[model samples]
Target: MNKLTTLNDHYALYVDGSCLENRDVSATTPAAWSLVIVTGDNGLGKGSGEILEETWGSVITDSSDSAFIGAEVGSNNTAELTAIAEALRWLLIDGGNRPAIVHTDSQYAGNLATGNWKAKANKQLVAMVQKLWREVGALRELNWSHVRAHRGHRWNERADHLANRCVNNQAPMPLSFWKPGQR
Candidate 1:
């Protein structure tokens, strides 16, 4: 298990994914991914820390079909993987050199990205995320932590909400500027 390096300035990114009709997903299914980046570590509770950034969007598929353009050909796994990729991409480009930890509820994603489990499906997406993980490691410390879903974990629940909102075509909440403990 890769442990997070102790750092006061490290960032915590809570990510989640949502898919509409997951069991019946097809080439036109809707799925979305979201991430909430924060600082501080009062544990992973509601007031865990102050929100530094929040982002959510449709999950783009590897397919080139126009009908399946944005989030159409997506599944829960794809959304989960994409959320991780986007979070790492953000850290690589805009996160300075600060160490960061990504918290996710998907054990599948966590295991695959950290080499704890071999991927049997979605090889391409898995490869992309693994590559990005390596790239981010080259610059600063990056680690993954498994967070249980829907257990009232603040940022994790927020990420779930944002992803669901995106899947429903609703506007995302402005959590980036939201102070801790504010409803």
Candidate 2:
């Protein structure tokens, strides 16, 4: 049985979007993103592979951003936004109301989330993410920051792995460990 434990009131999430197909049109390629929750322990949180002290990894099924100019599937931007939205959504539903610091290697994702950048292409998709963040703000404080990619950051590496797993159509390891509300 999973044990009840006191968790940090806040979490740091390293998010990455991976598109290994290297196609000009994302519609023809597979792309994915991941958000790895950072904890005091280097190991997986409490059970199986819980992201934080207690949270599940999210897999986004919708790859297309059909807003403004419809974004093709497997686009790195879409994947990044999807990861961010899923993280906020999960935090909202979990009702932990804990503050979150989101780290993204993509300057666009980080800047846009923090209102430092404007969307010129995927306007609709950006709007949707903005809406989600606003909703998250009602329940928890959210901060956005940028991180250098391929620098050997542990959480970032894990997130990168998760993103690649999605591209390969493989499930994130944590999903096989436990289900939300089960432990």
Candidate 3:
């Protein structure tokens, strides 16, 4: 497998989105995004490497409170896309040049950000994510990979937990407070 296919020898960022009521999502829907950055060799594996940072927040509108007023609506896909965008933004600020890889369980997010699929909805959000992807790529080596969700992947699971915590209006857990395989 190519380097992109493998999780070793690179900084890995695992991101996830959570929406408790995804069927009929709206501006008031309980949705959030979270990302976990890992460092060291074989960082993707369970109980290995260090949890460098864990960040999460609720999905809210840009300005207007009304979803009908061109404000962002909270949904699973939007949360997922937002997670990727926020991850890229984090990298731009602190990622340095360490060949980084972003792992997500949402193929919709991975494909759309990588331009492998066209976005029929959420055009504004998708465009923003694509722009961040390009800007990050211009600075360093960046790659995006899709992982199966809720399949016992360590960092992915942690990201899911964090996102859900935000959806439930809980505070983010500190980086030093969590270790690999804690949950």
lDDT of each: 0.79, 0.62, 0.79
User: On a 0 to 100 scale, what is the lDDT of residue 12 in model 1?
Assistant: 88
lDDT string for model 2 (38-152, tens) is 6442223232223563222323334552322233455778778767776676667768766777767888877776567898766665777788788887787777766677665
Stretches > 4 Å off in candidate 2? 1-7, 41-50, 53-71, 171-183
What are the RMSDs of all candidates, in order?
A: 3.8, 7.7, 3.7
Candidate 3 lDDT, tens digit per residue, 86-175?
899899998577678889999999999888899998888888889889999888888888878877777887898899878888775655
Worst 10 residues of 2 by lDDT: 41-50
TM-score of each: 0.85, 0.71, 0.85
Q: Per-residue lDDT tens digits of candidate 1, residues 141-164?
A: 788888888777778878888898
What's the C-alpha lDDT at position 33 in model 1?
Answer: 91
> What TM-score does prediction 1 earn?
0.85
Name the 10 consecutive residues with the lowest summed lDDT in model 1. Answer: 64-73
Give candidate 3 misplaced runs (Cα > 4 Å): 1-9, 41-44, 64-71, 172-183
Clashes of each: 0, 0, 0
